[model samples]
Target: MGAPDFEFRADLLDQSNEIVLVLDPDTGEIVYGNATAMDVLGYDEEDLLGTSITTVTGFDDVESWAEHLPQDEDADHRGENEFVRSDGERIPVEASVSRTTRDGEDYIVVLVRDITERKERESELRRQKERFEQLFETAGTIMVVLDEEGFIERINDRGSKRLGYERGELVGEHWFETVVPDDVEPEVQSIFEGITTGERGGVDGHTNYVETKDGTRRFVQWHNTPIHEGDEVVGILSSGIDITERKRNEDELERYESFVKSAKDVILSIDDDGFFSYVSPASNSVLGYDPDDLRGTSALDYVHPEEKSEAESGLRSTVDGDGDDVTREFRFQRSDGTWIWVEAICTGCRGGGSDDVGIAILRDITERKEYERELAHQRDALEVLNEVVRHDIRNQLQLVTAYAGMLEGDLEGENQEYAATIRESGQNAIEVTRTARDLAATMIADERVASISLRHAVESPLEQVRSAYSDAVFVVDGAIPDVAVAADEMLESVFRNLLQNAVQHNDKAVPRVEISATVDDVATVHVADNGPGVREDMKDDVFGAGETGLKSDSTGLGLYLVNTLVDRYGGTVHVRDNDPDGAIFDIELPLAE
Candidate 1:
């Protein structure tokens, strides 16, 4: 019997890896330990067997442990306690203290489990939850929780700050009191009733206005979801985002779109597939197509066949993402099958995704195009007639005048006088023919860039004036600069006509013609004469074709040709009163580089 009891005690020690202390029921003292306990406390089993557990545990709660000790010396008290390790570190432990009879002596048996790692994990989880709650409370959006009956249960810091209320003051208040205006109460009540009765879906994304504590209105977009307890609705969780500025911008954009649709000019957009996506209401008057008819139809289909290739090329360029601006004129077939000219200006438009689109504005130019065509035809006809008269007819007239002069030189006496009269008549005819040829030449020649020196161009007409009026005083004022001009022959014709008109119209005994040239950035020639100035009533008509100041049979083409040629060179010619009471003709021409 004694050997069996000793073996049982050894087996109990081997089964536990903890420090087992069998203490006296009325006193605290250590009794035994396993090998693991002795190794953990940095002591040999023999040395720890008789030592108190408090010496290794370093616990100051000895009295509490004594009170919870087994009263009948047979029960156990389960508790968690702390112990100091051999390295002087505190460790959390769970202990079960029970009374046992060993050799008829009352003692305690204690079981312990280290729980330090478990406690550390619990602390880390607590800190993480606190961080998330802080983020939620400080978010920019207004967050609120409502009971199933739409009563406000809780509001975050942002919500209370926006509503001008203390965090605690808003709780238990009715949600609709703050959000729904009195005028819109019926509609709002219907919405909440639907939510509570489960008729309409919970307001996930609804935009409405809310009133602040100060009675000012605010626009908010609510995103609410039902907080469910099992299958039944318990409450609603809502997050509101302030969108007042965004709503205002949307309203302005809607007004702008309306204005664009009602504009007089056609505004349109085409997708990458070349189909019209948008067309303004003006399409009815401009393109002969209804606005709806243009949608889904290729805009290029209505273009004239001759212009289709160019229009397609531009469209393809836009689809390929080319950056060039597109501007082209094309003929579009109207509803009546008649073609009307349209000028289209297109720009490439790119959206968030897909291929590039094309935005275009089209304008009708049918009347302008028709006028241009008629003007071109008239110009071509006039050019051909002028060419024939100047080149062919004038050569024959020059030959007739030359033969008459030779015949007059051959004859003598009475026959010579008669031949002299014939020669004079022929000469007069030649002068008329020359003037006609010059006028025709002026009308036919291309008015493109033709540079001529100013001095050389003016000498020919000045010599003619000196020869014709030998007694008249003709002064070429100072040394004229060599001015390069685009229309040299036209300038010569202009000066010649003015000088002749000055000499012929003057009733003065000594007719004086002063020709002066002045040049700065632009070239100007002034021809002043001691002749009567143009009449006020005739001034406006002086530049008109076939208008003349002289009552005599002057063709009046001289001043008209001068005005026409000056305009062709982008120059100006006007008559002004001379400084000393004479007629002054001022001609301005651009200086050629």
Candidate 2:
């Protein structure tokens, strides 16, 4: 075919946009070329005429070109290959070829299209796939790609190592059966099925446990995404991190919080700036303040005015690490604006990447403080009473006795007898004053009960009573017990009062008194007198403050003092009828160790 013979069809062939070519299938020679072919291939009519088709198309030779052509008449074939331009640059092109017989000559028709943009898109997609594969294989955390059937299609090195398996050991395995714990396998399989079917969305940061090869469970936080092919989800891609240690720490923190909630004392924390940071639930019960009321407020604001300076100093020492730990007492103001004594133990603490904090445990001691104050007041009042009784009262009674003795010496008959009676009464008044002073001193003592020898306590008071009542016959029925009793220095006062009561209230012309003691778990002292026996009805109140037996004017402090001292020492005293005709005063005291 020559250019001049093709002039009539050139107008129709040139109107098409494609590079149209006519070739002789047997010789692989270009029979005709259109205007589009000349323009796209960058060739002229003289350069393309009689040119072999292999010169421009990506075909090795005439046979290869004929092999791609349709073997049957009117049948077309489509293929892609690069086209070599005049400048030697290759651009991808798609070609459709068919064989036809025109004017009874066998020839091939070819339509060529530029596919450079489409090829560029395909190349970009290939590059992106390669990048994704690289990232999936080398990621720092566990990465797994699962097929729609929940099979492990691929797993990264990190995922294999975390599950305690060698590389490639877990591939092609069912994900739930191989790694998911038995307890959670059912739930995990259900979720996986939902994701693959697009019934459920991808899960992000979902926490669960996975079983390792060694049968131990590790807590995992996972992120999952659905792999979509067009509009259908074909698989799931998952990434996860091992959070086992973090879960353990969270459990321990929860236990400590439980302890703080149930504690009896107030537990609180303050920051380095002396502001409250955390307060436990116990604060409401111990300090009458809710936890929220104290947080972010200055702790010193609750201290009593007189104790604020000391409390602030102690807080500073703890937060600054100067003292680290200190226990001090301060009066803290309650929510109701009342001050209460509290003993606070503050200790310094430090946390990661934060300022120092001070932890304080506060115990209320208001009752103890009040008891101490009452004791001190009692001591002061007792001291003043002791001064008045020991000096002024005893001195006045002494002068009355001296004047009555003088008058008895100068008088006669009934008048002198009356003077003698007045002198004896004055002497008794002086003795009563002595007993009252001893009782007052005992009441004010810090410890009114102590271990004292029972024999020593009984002997001194017995001798004193024997001298005062020379007319009375005092006998010891048995040896005094050489044991200790729980009584104070006032123990002697107890026996003295009993011995004098035995002799003074006797109705017999000569009073007979007997003292004996029997030791068992406790020391029992018995003082018996041959006096008018006490009535059974009055036995309980005989030790009343003013119940002097047979004498209304007498100050009945002796037996009353005995009762008070015995009771304070955790002992018992009672009066009963003696074996013959008198009263027996029995004193029972605990034996001190």
> How high is each candidate's TM-score?
0.54, 0.58
The Cα error of candidate 2 at residue 24, in Å, is 3.7
Model 1 agreement with the true structure over 11-71: per-residue lDDT tens digits: 7776666755556555466656666566656677677766656766675556655776777
Model 1's lDDT to the true fold?
0.76
Query: Pick by TM-score: which candidate is best?
Result: 2
* Per-model CA lDDT versus the true structure: 0.76, 0.87
Determine the backbone clash count of candidate 1.
Answer: 0
Clashing pairs in 2: none
Residue 447 of model 1 has an lDDT of: 65
Off by over 4 Å in 2: 3-20, 25-52, 58-79, 86-88, 96-98, 113-118, 229-232, 254-266, 279-297, 367-593
Lowest lDDT 10-residue stretch of candidate 2:
1-10
As a whole number from 0 to 100, the lDDT of residue 235 in candidate 1 is 78
The 10-residue segment of model 1 with minimum total lDDT is 1-10
lDDT of 2 by residue, 1-593 (tens): 43325577789999888888888887877778888888888889788868898989868888888778899786999989888888888889999998877776778888898888889999998999999889888888899999999899989998999999986789999888898988888778887888888998898988899998999899999999999999999999999989999999999989988898889989888898998888888778778999999999998998988888999889888888765588889998889988889999999887766664778999998998999899788888888989988998889889999999999999999999999999989878877887899889877776646789999999998998899788999999989988888888889999988888887788889999999999998899999998997998889899998887754345789989999989989999999998789999999999997
